[model samples]
Target: MENRAVLAAVLMAALLILYQVFFIPATAPPPPARAPEGVSKPVPPQEKTAPPPPAVLPAAKVLPRLPERTVSVDTPLYHAIVGSEGGRLLGWTLHYRGEKVLAERGQMGLSGLILERSGVGGQPVEFSITGGPVVLDGKAGEGTLVMTGEDAYGVRVRETATFRADQYAVDLSVRLENGRRVRQTLTVALPWIAPVKPGTDGAQWPSELVWQVDGTVHREPFDKATVAEETPGDWAGLDSLYYLTALIPKRPPTSPGLSLAVGKVGEDRVEVGLRGAVTLAAGEVWEARAQLYAGPKEYRQLRAHGLEGAINFGGFPLPRKYGGLPMEWLGVPVLLVMNFFYRFIGNYGVAIILLTVVTKVLFYPLTVKSMTSMKKMQTIQPQANALRAKHKSDPQRAQRETLELYRREGVNPLGGCLPMVIQVPIFYALYIALSVSVELQNAGFICFGRAPGWFPFVGGTDLWICDLAAPDPLYVLPILMGVTMFVQQKMQPTMGDPNQAKMMLIMPFVFTFMFLKLPSGLVLYWTVSNALQILQQRLMNRKPARVAGRGAKDVARV
Candidate 1:
């Protein structure tokens, strides 16, 4: 019996590993080869020994410098800033989450729309105010903000940003006019940036440069290569696990389309940007249009813009395969239900508990039958042992006779395992859901200060858990869960060799150690579940007559 349970667990683990290895696309490419430290490239030989009169430097490209002022725009969803210096998005804040989505704590606040001419030391095309501040009411469809300026090459650049009140998308239009009577090729870029702080909450989410090229999602980590693999589509930007700042073109760009650039900001953070370049002819006003979406990676919100692919649902988002046994099949439904529960309870901890209860209820009948079968096996153990000893010389005969005895008593050898085996998918699906759902970020179940006044040791202090998404700081939940699991295991009618029983006993501790670092929310779910099973088993044990068979059959020898 112990071997059967162990085999079931092993099979489930193998399937999950295979699914991840074979199905989940590689979001992070191989790290590029590193340059040898302390070994500089060999200097090329010069034709003449005399350093030819200081190699001429390329001409500096500049734009008219306007007095730096932050233009503030407020919407129901987010607050944004446009710097007059470069007409760049300086700051962006999501109101509900109180998180800054734009660049902070670094130079080069070229956070949104900026243009660069093709020359050495080329400055970004900074715009001057072409009109008064544009305002959009929440009831309105669109609010337009326009700024116009000229580059050092005398090329007129007009930038227009149409902000919407109902959604996170901003319609961006950039027009380059070659008013200088000379054609110019300028690199147009929509920069999306967030400071990288390794090994923090910020590091928990993957931050990478992602773009679609011919329908394939190509992602490059910010700390990876500097030069990007020039993807063709104008859809490119940076994203973290929970939020996405992307530039999606209304139409694909001409030749020399989407290119990526990665840079380091001081010693602490890295910057990633996607640039789209287009050539403008003399007396032409070439407009490059794209929609900028910078906000939380809510599935429904992003799905509306055909950017649903950005929401990594912790598994393949394709239609159900393996006859709907895929993790996504269960995970998505569980997540949606949990979200619905949160709407009423307003607490994720409560929602998770409700979900656990719902799962337990759904499997209640199967679990009861499994427990009854285990109890029957426990009752027949002595006779089974006697038969094993009597027929020790005939192994096949002993197995056949044992199966006959079990059938005569109406017992199922595999009954204890089959029910649990069926639940592996649902368990894993819930686990994955809890791991990656952004709604659980910073959600709290129990905090010391929030505890009741009479609660011992944990009341009026920060000693207990503060965030359900993080591990239990005091390790209390994991230890309790381990203890409950062990108790449940002990209460079960486990019929096995002594060594096997000892191994089964140790499984609880092994699981406890494995779950120590998992999110407290998940641990809480497991703990509650284990406690419920123990209670259910105890109740079932008191009703032994319910599963009792005829006395003669129950006493039959194998």
Candidate 2:
């Protein structure tokens, strides 16, 4: 019981630390006066400026007359809109696990390509399409949208966006023909911006710019007055909780002109994107070919495209340079197994339950060893108390006798503690996976959408618990989790100081309060895990071995 309490305390303290690091609400800075939509030039991180100014469009010296009509492209994986005047992407909606992440943000244009010149004045080329609203039926012959236009300033531009009915990626190519007599350098910006959704406080909003620089991923929150960074990378974009919009250059720019910018577009609105530069000489036709991905941030899908770096599984509060260490190493395997189970079970909640069962089965041997060691220690509690009483006059003698007693009984004092410690990484891995996996967002185990008769008041999933990604509205899971934890603690063999045992009893309540507002899926994982531990403990401790002829004898073999 002492070892059990120690293990519980250590686990709880670690969990609280992790929770504070990952989930504590980020304090939003005082709202700045709304800034205009544009790219803010990159600034040195150490410098401070008074009333940091808004960003400017790298591609446009003056804002062009954007078209009123928006062209829509519908595909199986995503839906996108493009404006006619600038041929800019106006909106992108991601569909995954039967949930729409960006559809409700009305007219939220996500990712689009652009062109800019440093000395050239006047709005960048305003593209006019000859034909539009391409509808692709991902078949033997896929559909495509081609928009072509030319500027009077000796530059002609053509943008062709091809879509397939079944894939999330949009094959895009921007061809620029420089008809000038001298060489010209143009800044190409692919802005991937989405309107911040309503009803979400600044703390809950995960709006951010994420990118990979030299094989390392960097994530920056867009809540500040201005944020701009230049890096050397071929891929960059922005993301929310479930959706991602990224641009990958088929050919990297000549110079490391990759920069990220985020600025306010209107009241309660933010726009973000990446900018790069390309130089064109007289009569030189330059074509920038790239792939655009706008869809859910599913691990498998992102991994297939080498964008797995996008999925962040939170780990120890170490600096990101440490790579989140053991958690990242373990999280991927756990997530893969969960995804595999989900394929067969067809529900994330059920998958999590199966995951817990499998983990228990895998660790059965260690658990049995730990429990057996603790039970042996409990069996010798009377002798241990007598020794302490006998040695009341000699503190050193009592400690020596205790060590001798353990050795004579052939019980390893560290056995009970080591096994529990070994199990920490596995549980931590599952915690990180459940919290970050896109597959769990809006997933339901016993959803009312599938079975309305089961849930009346909260018609989402499992009676009162509807969305697994969100908290349990009625707090039933958290309470049950606390109860199971208490039961598991009670099942451990009692051989600890009274004060420490009392502390163990209060831990469950502390955990219950702490988990009140966490994701239901996470709480469900804990509750199921605790119940399994209880069942395992009961089975292991059912028939205690009896002492006979100076040796322990088992009545039945486990």
Candidate 3:
């Protein structure tokens, strides 16, 4: 008996040590490296030298041929045609397909492609296209497409359809004839260029994407790989999560100039502006064409526009970070299905509820078997307790006898936990899906309040109670959840000491607090699931009781 007690103690100790060592805290893989801080131009590799300088076009050779028919030009920027069949442009070339800005220069500080300026009120002079004097069916029709700056701060150029057939491929161009010799410095802000590394002082990694001039190369620094706060304000509110600058080469003789600036307007938007400067002779025209992309991180649209690697779906902290990929992968299918269902249902909240129901139905068999096993064990608890009392001084013997009792009753001690273990991954997957799905970011639910903010709060207060996303501050949902769990436990046959029932009672509140901050969508699922489990248990309990004596001896075989 003494030897058996020692052996049991050693085995239990070993199991506990193994559990602590292997399962206590899960670790994730290392993340990718972040960009370095401060500006240091990247040196071209000796093996791959920079290409020879571009050929400059002279004024006479580059001038467009004038058409016989005269048309009135009324826009602030003069629109002119270059070739008989080429497109027309105001002072600049009309880049209908959009031109990538290699680099820009102006009265601003440049970091990569971000240009920063203070006190400048006028719009940054950039490229713009002149709408068509398009000819349709060989008949001249008049319509103007004007691309201009919203304010003195920036320019927005959009494609416009012209009725002129000859204008299909117009050669658009811009000419900047400045009166003063502007002292402008150019900076490259292309993603293809090496990223600005994070500073050693642990300053926030500059939240910007890199752009390339020569080729379609872009790189978005992974949020997990860097320590940077997503600046909040109008820009963030606008949901313009990421930004990039294009780098284009200079047109001619005047030095290629690039400018990038970063500025903040109070607590509103963090504006990033890029400008290209050309020093013009009194009558000389310094022209450059550039393309700008300003929108949400729509990966497909961005890639279609030849802007690759510019979409940054911010990654969360560590072990959680590793989970992003799997979560996104799972989300794709779930979102698709949910979207389809929502189209038919017209209610996101109802869709979620229906989705939960479908999931429960699919998992019902496993749950049913688990619950049935628990019931059987509950029925046999009296016998298990008798065995425990019989060998009170010898735990090993008691445990072995309990096992024998379980076997005779055809009960598996781990049966109930097995199904629960399987459900954990799915639950976590749902958690991740709800957190990052942009569709759900600002989605609304039934009166529970706006879906939830990035994090939960009560009426914008920090106090934990009003956080509906988290636990019910009133303890209503959690209390109900706990009650259901307690009933589930009661309905199940007991396997260990009756004292453990108190521990089971504590689990619902523990889980409730843990889930309070979670999205209401998740909470709804759990609440429904708990209710269903209770209903299922009640139904299961209604079945006739098993004849005990006949199965008692048979339990040892299992």
TM-scores, in order shown? Answer: 0.73, 0.78, 0.48
TM-score for candidate 3: 0.48
Count clashing residue pairs in model 1: 0
Clashing pairs in 2: 38-55, 39-55, 39-56, 40-55, 59-116, 90-109, 448-460
Which stretches of candidate 3 lie above 4 Å from their native place?
1-125, 128-325, 392-397, 445-492, 513-517, 544-558
Q: Rank the candidates by lDDT, best first.
A: 2, 1, 3
Model 1, global lDDT: 0.68
**Each model's Cα RMSD:** 20.0, 20.4, 24.4
| Candidate 1 per-residue C-alpha lDDT over 293-331 given as tens digits, one digit per residue, 9 for 90 to 100 | 777766667767766555544443332332233464676
What does candidate 3's lDDT look like per residue over 319-396, in tens digits?
433553334444445555666677898666566677777777878898888877777776677667677777899999
Candidates' lDDT values, in order? 0.68, 0.68, 0.43
Give the distance in Å from residue 385's predicted Cα in candidate 3 to where it truly belongs: 3.0
Residue 101 lDDT, candidate 2, scale 0-100: 47
Q: Is candidate 1 or candidate 2 better by TM-score?
A: 2
Q: How far is candidate 1 from the true structure (C-alpha RMSD, Å)?
A: 20.0
lDDT of 2 by residue, 1-558 (tens): 999999999999999979976998634233334222222122233224255333232232233566456778776676677776556665555556553545333345543455665555334456666555667655533566777766655667888777777667777777776666555566766665555453452222337767776677777666552434445564676676766777665543443434545555565565655555655545556555667777777888787667778777765645456655636678898889999999898888999899888998999999988988888877776666777878899989998988887787787889888999988878877888888877777787665443454567645445555578888777889999999999999888885699889999999999999999999999998999899888888887776744322432221210
